[model samples]
Target: METCSLPRRKLAAPLLALLTTLSLPTPASSAEIHSYTLPQQAYSGSRERHYKVYVPSAMTTPAPMVMALHGCKQTNDDVLNDWGMKAAADRYGFILVAPFITSYDGLRNENCWGFWFEQHIHQGAGEVEDLHQIAQQVDAAYSIDPNRRFITGLSSGGAMSMAAAVAHNDYWAAAAPASGLPYSEDSSSVSLSGQCPGSATFHAVSQVVSDLTGEVDNGYPIPLLLLQNKNDCTVLQTAANNMRDAHLQVFGSGDFKTAATTKASDTSCSPYNQNNYSCHRIAYTQDGTTATRSLVETIFYDGPLTTPNAQDTDHGHYWVGGAEGNNGKWALQIGPSYPDIIWDFFSRHSRNGSQPQGHPVIVLQGDNPLTAELNSAFSDPGATANDLEDGSLNVSADCSAVNTQAAGSYSCLYSATDSDNNSTTATRVVNVVDSNSPVASCQKISASPYAHIGAGRAYVGGVSSLRAYANGDNVDIGGSFDTWSSVALYEGETGKWYSQLPAACSGTGGGFVCQNWNTTNLNHVTAGRAYYGYYTVGGNQYLGSLPGVNSWVKETASGYFQAGQCSN
Candidate 1:
């Protein structure tokens, strides 16, 4: 991540030139906007407050709610008209709430939310309390889905949205703070005057949410989708980065993991840690056992407003341009459609509980064999199963078609089912071949880069040993062909062999010994069972067999490693 330093030179000249040529559009007549005044007592330390609600015609019972807060000098109507959020509400079938902040003497900008004030930012106080009360009022009046409620804001409003999310994580399922600051206690003063204060230190998301929700150990994490403009001058890009890191810390506990990110011509979708969180704590569940999942997504757009005839290099601080008065200001020039992206992220999550399926894990006892000796008795090695929520599971193996008397490749099927009936399958392969002497082929007699085994190895105290091996005539003697050599193990019981272990060999000789070769853990190996070993070199494989000394083997030894039983 390269730091974006504000270009000190030629910054104001280009901005002034761009603003001079800009033309504001006339307000469009909108019938969806409805005005409502909150009771004076609803918000203390503030005068009469008015809020507007936009209920889309397509809204049905129990629809999601989106609270949009406007920036300084921007009105609810400006945000509704300019931000182009109403179309999203109509498309997504969610109720839109836009509130207005009347003039105040100490305000740096006209009609700005008091995001800097401690009372407004604090939980259950001033504007924060007012917003909560208004949400409750809206819930009482309309069929708003309490589990699917959301909030977003631009600039100061963006900062306020962060405050709201942090102070009241219980109310909002997710928050999208567009070009806003993460709420911090150190900054005593906040303004929309284009001069941001120094960056403030913040707590981890887990700690903050736990403190706010009073569930120190098991609090539900509020999902966040932070939107930023690389060229945002009003709210520095650093502020956006700080906010993102802060939220990721909250959701990821300082180890934020990115799940997937897609970059299109005009839009980029970077969803973080997908399918990971089972939001059981905040989920609204009817069965008391099921829960839904949540995710955190972040998006950063490049320079210039997407609107036509807009400046290509300027601070994108305004809502997206389709509003009558926008005049192509404060929009991204080459990035995802902001409104659509926001609605898409908001629609994917809900506190309404939905059961999540947990997949079971299957562990095979033996490795897939590259080759098996003919006329050998085959037995099922079996497997173990475990599930996240269902605990231990019953695993079954079927090797009915294995014919060790003939030389051919075969597969054994293994399946497992959990208590919830969720099942998974694993396959092990076996190869039987005629007794053929392994050819002694050594391209270069150099020390194997990997670990190797010793002949007739002994395990003291009845402990099992796991080993790795690799051999190939073309195996790089210079230690560069680390990926070329491999080993496989054949389970006598299942007649199945597992071949996933890579060879890490060391020792300079035609028969270089390898260690760390076992595919399955030594603990999982069956006691008193003989497991056959096979090594591959340059596409040619050598099977271990007793009384079959060839150029590849100077001594005809046991073709298998016998596991010793340990007394308890």
Candidate 2:
């Protein structure tokens, strides 16, 4: 909820530095570029174009597909050049497919997704059809799980993504639109008992639900992911919030306020509580004009999930899987690892095509390097409030004890007391390192003094690599053959830390250069620990390390925000 408008001095310094380094790679390089050419003229009248896809080797199975749509006046390559989806795909196996939208307003490649409800030469339905055909073509060629298909966009493309989802109920499993106009039509009010005819009839939000999954069945419903930032000027965050409540209602969830808080809550959902969907909303602000200031929020609804979002500080457009450019701002603004969370949701829920196993279970991510000690007084519910409420316990590992074979990995035994003082025992194998594990010590660097793009706009970069001192006989690091990477946020005001990289990046195949962003090379750090990792944004790549608290001071902005060594 805090807005970080980039200061003019800070902006100018970074921009100047970027101008000098635009053609050179920073000494701490973390990522490389991977490009993909679009199907060559699969259809006549098609434009000769190629899309750059970032696929991380961390992906094991053929991951889900995220189709990122570009905004008006933006080319697919430009979007790809900006979002850094390739880094996310490389960190996780999910496939990223970004489609190019041709420019219609005299700007080449500036045209947005075919306007469904907007004034345009192409009907929104036609645009949706074209997207569907492209997805079909890609699915046939690759091992994409169609059931886990997702779509997202920004500005015109953002609104278009929503409209496309509405038009093709059978195609996208879920959709998220950042800084775009709200649904031009009310979709929740319609009763989806019968066939939906005409665009107007399908406009209602509720009708979208029924059309996607036949029969308007309440017991089984598709999930919807919603990400909105407060204080957003382009597309009002408030509208996105309203849409969340509306979509929940369409899912047949009732309004129920929490006992402790006055805010209305819903029970029909998990991860993001039924009523407290706002809790999952990620908000941040920066300097710059309309194109640069906007941030992104990724939502995953419906079912069939995989690894959640992955984190990287890449300023490129491939920040989030298939979604790139303006969409990447929305993706990375929420920190680096969000794509992994999105993919996790896709892989876990897509295969079944039905509801999840039970109440949303919070599985602990096991990427931290330290080891955690379980409370000897463990019960059937484990320990702490989260356990009592959600049947899970999230405890930080002891950083000093990390690196042992047992580092970030521990076993816990639990016993329960019955009404008559009876006892039962339960054993659990806790994987402190959720995805790939973290390395012990590494030479870390950061973009503390990030470069500024313009008013309210700035770019940050950092990197981390294995340190010889941290990897000795004392450590047992054998999770993945590839190295891992991560990035964190230090509150400019509070001097606290926010875990930025959720998943580690690794390589699919080492080529002329090494690409390591996975468990073997890098591992997850404890929630409140300092670390480093590789970050990629579009064509720009850098190695960033976590800075100590209060590393930045609000000086006259003549120099970079200098930070000190992080401490406990």
In candidate 2, what are the lDDT values of residues 434-550, reduced to their tens digit? 224322111122222121111111222222322211111112122221234322222221221222211221121211111122221112221211122322221112224432112
The global C-alpha lDDT for each of the candidates, from Candidate 1 onward, is 0.50, 0.36
Residues 134-194, model 1: lDDT tens digits: 6665665566677788899887788888878777877887788887776752233332354
lDDT over C-alpha atoms for residue 69 of model 1: 85
Name the runs in model 1 displaced over 4 angstroms: 1-31, 42-46, 103-105, 185-218, 253-295, 305-314, 321-335, 353-568
- CA lDDT, candidate 2, residue 266: 28
How many clashes in each structure? Answer: 44, 112
Best by lDDT: 1
Candidate 1: residue 421 lDDT (0-100): 80
Cα misplacement distance, residue 57 of candidate 1 (Å): 1.3
